[model samples]
Target: MTQSVLDKAFRDVVIANRILANEGVVDAYGHVSVRHPLDPTRYLLSRSRAPELVERGDVIEFDLEGKPIGGDTRPPYLERFIHGAIYEARPEVQAVVHAHAEAVLPFTVSTTPLRPVVHMASFIGARIPVWDIRDSFGDTNLLVVNMAQGRDLARGLGAERVVLMRGHGFAAAARSLPEAIRMSVYLPLNARVLTEAMRLGEVKALSRGEIEAHASMKPDDPAMWRAWEYWAVRAGCGDLLTARP
Candidate 1:
């Protein structure tokens, strides 16, 4: 049972890496990570390869401090601190995705808050918090390059499941890989829809109660599997025949 769990986590991490790219949730610059099944204090992430190219072997183990433990020779992402600190902060979250989505960028810079403009995004509730790196550490490269910066960002993130970095990108956290990938994908789609609707007229966003109901509910597993399957196939996942999980 333990081996099965570990194997599934590893494979799902690979699937999520590819799914995010195939779904346009991430391109060359973004990244994803999944909590280690054998040890909660560690995680699985790829060396500095592009998302689409992250094969199973490219995945490396990192401790809670985000230090590579498996002697992985490839360069690790500097922003890995982003994933590390969030995992430390949120024990319930097993998956994390970070992306610089074009559609989400406007809301991060403007006073216009990104809301639950669609059903798939109702889990985002009434507002997605924006973490202004400038307010904490002014006038430098925007990357959360170190553990201290990562902790500060996590503090800003607080209880929210998603956070938008001012002048940078956004992070999505979930209890499962599919849900994390789903949020990463929908954030941009929701942003695009909201942007267009804003041009047409004032948009009526989902109500707090509506968002609350969805939050209280169990995830629709079949729907999630379908999404994962579609993305897995589209991304040319190595073993699509039995990849669902």
Candidate 2:
């Protein structure tokens, strides 16, 4: 990629961090990353910093193995393996988000699965798989810090766009940064809506046909841009809207 194209990717990653923070999909704990436009073998993620405060300078390039390139000494997120392993396993994924939104936590632990109940979250499909750390590693702190744990989690994700990590958060993958951000923001909203609908009566999630239709929406669609612009302004990164990929 040219210098301009590479700068745009970093800009989008910074904006994604802030947008997810503003939208409550992520806060101080979560991280987001995008595959390098010039080299798929490398990806960009911010150094250890709160999502809301991430900036272009904080963005670091990492190999698919999750090791920071260029010998950058800044600390990295412990669970960055989540991004690397997924990118390694799924060649189609261009962006990855790992968030611990409270609304999504209940479904991670409970038998009730998180599904797409609203049109915006249709990318999640009818059901989301849950990856329990205990199932593979036997009792330990629930973090995808190593390649082994990350690969197992990726296996659980399989062909799904989203997967809940038991006792933790959910990891979302997408073909673009905007789509990944859209899924991250709407996943919790869908969960919250599903919770309320369940309290009233039997919850009717989107039918298979409905999901298939809505999931066809692409990241570059006008509607997606509208959502991204609205979120960028809300996150105080409106100026960066021009830098979109």
Candidate 3:
């Protein structure tokens, strides 16, 4: 069968994920997914492969039920449940990105929460809750592979743009793969700024009102996409911005 639109979208996500991975923002542990085109009950994401090295043919397809539908792949991400459950709960979300960016990884292992010390993180506001999977399972490395845990994480995220997985990593969502990538890149930058500010002493979070004000201050600027396009071209994936699956 010819590659479907859903497969193409998955390829785009894989490309962006690889770019971040090559930059060391995301390594072997993270995953990215896009909602299926014709089937809202399905999604497209990379299977068990190094995110930085993923190619178009490496993408996989799966339904909400977690059954693999595409690729001659072996197995999918163990935490595929996260993608399935999030899409199940939030119809407005079209893409999801989970990465262990260096700046955010430290906070995930610490007792303190990631306060919104910068404007970027302020999009979610205050302290983003760290979902402690270690507490849920006996081991910190246990993957959230079931619907029950997935739904719990979804509830913690609610309508927010990101969720911190305690002792693990974090997840970010957006309307498209590129937009989701923007959130992933921005989130770590926000966390790094907050962490450094904490070391320097007293850091104040942007108030909810201030965040709203900032939103009105700049509506969907092209700076990020432009930057991504530049780097993507250098990384040899410039065509991804317009390529279908």
User: What TM-score goes with each of the models?
Assistant: 0.94, 0.97, 0.85
Model 3 TM-score relative to the real fold: 0.85
Q: What C-alpha lDDT do the candidate models reach, one value each?
A: 0.85, 0.91, 0.73
What's the candidate order when arranged by decreasing lDDT? 2, 1, 3
Off by over 4 Å in 2: 243-245
Model 1 residue 157 lDDT score: 80
- Candidate 2 is scored at a TM of 0.97
- lDDT per residue for candidate 1 within 1-245, as digits (tens), equals 89878777777888888888888878898999999977989989888888988877888899978899966667999899988999999998788898998899999999999998799888765668999988878996999898888888888888888999998999888877877888888889999999999999989999988888778644437777777777788888848335454
In model 3, the Cα lDDT at residue 49 comes to 78
lDDT of 2 by residue, 1-245 (tens): 49988988999999999999998888789999999999999999999999999998999999988899999999999999999999999999999999999999999999987888888788886769999999999988898889999999999999999999999999999988888998899999999999999999998888889899987787788788888888999999999876333
Q: Which of candidates 1 and 3 reaches a greater lDDT?
A: 1
Q: lDDT score, residue 155, model 3?
A: 78
Task: Please give the lDDT score at residue 144 for candidate 3.
Answer: 77
